[model samples]
Target: MPIKLHDFQQEVVNKFFKSGSLLCVLPTGTGKTVVALEIIRRLKEQYGNKTKCLIVVPANLRSNFVDTIRKFQLKLNAEIIQKVSQLDQAYRTKTILVISYDFMRLYALKLLRYKWTLIVADEVHYAKNRQTKNFAVLYQLRLNSRHFLGLTASPIANTPEEFFTILIIVTGDRSIFAEGMQLIKYMEIGRKDPTWWEKLKATLTGRRPRSKKGELIPIGIKDIEAFRRLVGRWVYIPHYSKIEKLGTRPKVKSFVVRVDLDDFETKAYKYALRKIPRQDLKDLKEGTITNARLRQIKNIIMACQQTLLSPDYIYEYEERGQEGVEQSNISLFRPGSKIKAVAKFLKQTGEKTIVFSSFLRFGARLANHYFNKLGIKSREYSGAVKPQERKEIIKQFEEGDLQVICLTGAGQEGMNLPSCKNVFFLNLPWHGEILRQVVGRALRITSKNPFVRMFWLFAYTKDGQETIDLWLSNLIKRKDIIRNAIFAALQETTANVSVQLPSYEGPRPKSKRKPDTVLGINYPR
Candidate 1:
């Protein structure tokens, strides 16, 4: 049986072959991996034994690529290089080598000795920070490979800097955008009005610097029209909405479940906030906290956020029990309202659900509550578990052995969870793109559900006092506004039919709402 690709995916493959390097921005669950695999098959057929590919993914996602290969019956020789010792044999024989970002960083120099015909960075945005070893190694790898592919659903998460870093790695041109703000000047909206750029910067950063004289008037849309025109040559975005072959993805109904904190929670949250130095809070308001002070402020904010989740987390319980498993006797501490709300909702829904939480301990507590308290089969999926155990946990969830899987940030990206159609967020992620990635795990093309349900748990005090939940949610909303405007520019770009290969020259680079019903559940006031 031959592998068939959607028309848009075929277009992505065409772009990659013509340009030799591409930043593929396909929406999640739309088969980005299939496209990459198709490319590899062609490479193998064209180049044969000479075809060597390097796939860099987050540690947890390495297995996903390997599994897809087997599932599709693509008898490709793929190897997972765990330690430096195994690299020599794999480098010599394995046509496809899947290495995690962390392992690649650790053994970059040694791995660099081998030549790769193609390199694919899965979830490449992990290298957004130029200072980290992630970016450094990826840049070197891209330079070594004859063809490079950067795969990510959301290219510009929060700021242009992320896209800029990826641009540098893909093109090896560091001077194109100098800084992220330079990329913004090319936007048509800002080019027509320089003040628009400044306002945008201020709004995105929550800091307003005095407008300076002699600002660079954007050369013109011809110089580079926003992000799309600038990186137009090297980037190909096949959005899910535009894919006719997909017919229509399962509709996702999102709701914000407001959980009211009980008296104990309210008092604990207020006390934690009050314990923070008044001066630090003032600095936060003024947006003048030093980097050191910023860390302290984050710690305080984290403490208060934990206060809403569980008292066990607030007390700093070990993420895993003494037996090296995530199971914990959460009964020791009174479960918080948020936990009760999540458990109750899962009980009522009685479906496979993935509950995402930032805190590892909170994830453990939720899993414990589901099984021990509610008699619902559950397990904790986090980095704390061994790779094999994580695989088994996912299997159990898929096979109906587990009713719910409490996942941490580790499993947010690249993990396919089409088995589950319900996603619950214990709290909001720092970036909007992460929120999308987590939701994408359940929105698979193979899903049987007619629609997916996503719920975000937000805690508030009855007295109308603003909690950190409200603050974070509002912040994400504002960031989403900026993210939407930037990516929306890509929609305006006219696709080029002529296949002109790109040179390593320079850089470049919202929703209506129906009132969702609040979960009508009673909590002790």
Candidate 2:
């Protein structure tokens, strides 16, 4: 079968012009990878079989490239090699090499030695920080970069400069930005579109409509089927009752546990905050660091987060533990609300849980300090873990050999642990997208248990000293905005189609969310 492109996808790809460097920003499920593959096909046809391409993706996605290559029957010799020693073993012939971002950073100089025809970076938002290894290596790689393609679903950045900065790394020439900006200014794309097109465009851009534009009508199971026929892969959301009847409903209950930071953590956090400029803190949350001092900033951020868990060095947060903490008590060495919260939840539920942490160091610390101290079998999953060990860890967790597994971003997407019904975020998520991903680990249609419980732990308080997470708060608000947008879109798009589910719920998962906005852009609903 030939690859099918939707009107929206075809339009975007047709407009791309296949210039030397390109940034393709499309939503998830809209087939960004398909667009990328199409671009590679055209390039290979024109540039000949000798053209070399490099795709740097998340570690879990290493096999996806190989599978895609096989499925499409692309003649390019594709290899997913992260080891620097193995690069020599690879054929000198033109090939497409797949690697992780961490590998690129680790072997930046070695990989840069290779002359590449094209470079494609997926999940490009991670390249926002210039001081970070990814950004630095990417900057240097641009010197030899010829054809470049950047792909991402979310253009996550607090500022336009930060967002466009990654394009600079891709393009290698900053002058292109001036030309791009000039083109954007003169372009008619952003101008007001027609009413019907505007509504469709809002859906395309993930914007919430201003109001509920249609009415919900009572319909039978056939109606739901029609809706599913119209919009593929989204029927499971609105037709909840029908799906539940089919035993496909994944029950997910979410809670946010409010906790306060201990004095040691407070002191460390305050000191770190004082050292860095205030805006940088906000920028880091957005995953964009314009400042070159990201090493120090990241260290400071790590220290603050570590205080919640146990830092390797006791002196990281304070010279000692709390004022009267006993030397024998584990709290003496490791004491914070995050640990206490996890320990409490584990003791209470005694259920296997996956505690997710933002940083790999924090994940390791949490497993070692809290879970191990509780006499529970625990493991850590991150980039540091060998691939084989990661598979072993997952197997152990499934077999009940491990009661808990502390995970970083590395383990979020790959694991299909429907058997594990409990997930705890020992730390606040950077954004709503991450929160969704974390919950998705345990919450699935095929969940082993009937219910999945997720506890999202946050340190929010009246006092300004402990921690402030406006980003998390605001990101969550968008969830409801998105939900409402979906509801309205369904009601309107499916109206003529006459699709609905009989015996449906009173209302589609009510989220008492008022209108909200982010970065001054009104998220319509």
Candidate 3:
């Protein structure tokens, strides 16, 4: 059977009915592609049979779309392929061609030759940056071109001006939401209307026709009209609750594992810390430091952190803009107590686990050594891994073929590994966005009772204490420090943007800390 449009999708298609361009904001895994497919069908029939469509998505998602097309049996009526090169080679006319944003950037002039009847950009948030090459290429290709569409789960911007730019591109009207309808306000509107809320639920989900077409719940026309007026005919469906349909999440317990740094590690960390300019550190807190200096400080901190884990990671960047060579091959090797600690924990539990490091070389080294010596199957994933192979490795890990999967930043976002109930953090990222994404990977929802055991291996400062143990706590502190420092440094009249960090509440075990810190978060089962 051909993929039929759900009521939510149908409503969107009806809104864009004869319109040439649209910006749809639906959640991920919600079949935005189906909406795109429906729009394509409607355009071909109403606009003209000769009208063609182009789709741009992240490189990793290209194959997923190809699979989605075949799985939905869209081949009968839709002209969809995996990549642009395939279509370019054929020189055959296909109504729809799917390509990556990278491809679009590299071959912008060549692709601009085609008068695209419609262009759909999936994960449209990539275009939020007006200065990006992707943004530049997309703008050129869609110049004066009608029938362009953009899609994203979240359309967020740090500043109002940035948000306005997105609004103009999406609505094609500078006056859109001119009454100061903030994007945050639009996100909150769904909770106030039940009918719209239902459509939102349907839009975020990818479930099949659980209810018959006649029995399907319908959203109110008046509500839709009101939303249209507010956000300008653009579909802005934000999840009222991120995991509402996931039922219940497993218990998340956080326990800190403090390891004493050896003599070599202590000397290395102290040396690095001493070399860092105290004024730069002060500037970081005062928000007076340049971005370059802030990054340099961050790199120093990260290197010291790595040294605590494995002293072999310490590298001195020469003034020549390259790393200094070591005296001997053995000089680069060290007794990695941190790696030993992780392996000990894994050996004791002997269950499915995910080990995360911030660097690919370290993660790969750890994974390779563990598997080689212990004869335990494992794999490492990072930007270095082939896109196709990453999927296969994740599949194998999920299927229990691999006992563990060591990963860098790649594991942080939107990858499902619910089967692994245990997570070991070998290194922590300073960015809250990254830290949250990593911890979230091991989280899985199930009807039955499920528990997640999270372990954080951290080293102490000169005073022998970890300033921040919890990622959320550290994030909150970091925000306060930076905002205050920036405000103080600039002494500008501009108001500070309020911070809104996600907070989840659930049952909590008794804590010896302060009462407020006991807010039932990170379910400890």
Per model, state how many residue pairs clash.
Answer: 0, 3, 2
Best by lDDT: 1
Compose the digit string of candidate 2's lDDT tens values, residues 426-495. Answer: 6655445565556656655456787666665556332533253333443333222323332334422222
Structural RMSD, model 2: 13.2
Sorted on TM-score, best first, the list reads: 1, 3, 2
Give one digit per residue, the lDDT tens place, for model 1 in 263-349: 877877777777678866644433233334445577677767776776545444234423432355545557678778878877786
- For candidate 3, lDDT tens digit of each residue in 3-76? 58655556567666545566665433345767787677667775665677778888766655556667777642
Ranking by lDDT: 1, 2, 3
Better of 2 and 3 by TM-score: 3
- Model 3 residue runs over 4 Å out of place are 1-48, 75-92, 152-169, 172-237, 246-263, 283-293, 296-298, 315-341, 367-375, 410-418, 422-424, 435-457, 461-463, 467-525
Candidate 2 lDDT (Cα, whole model)? 0.55
lDDT at 153, model 3? 46
Clashing pairs in 3: 20-147, 252-523
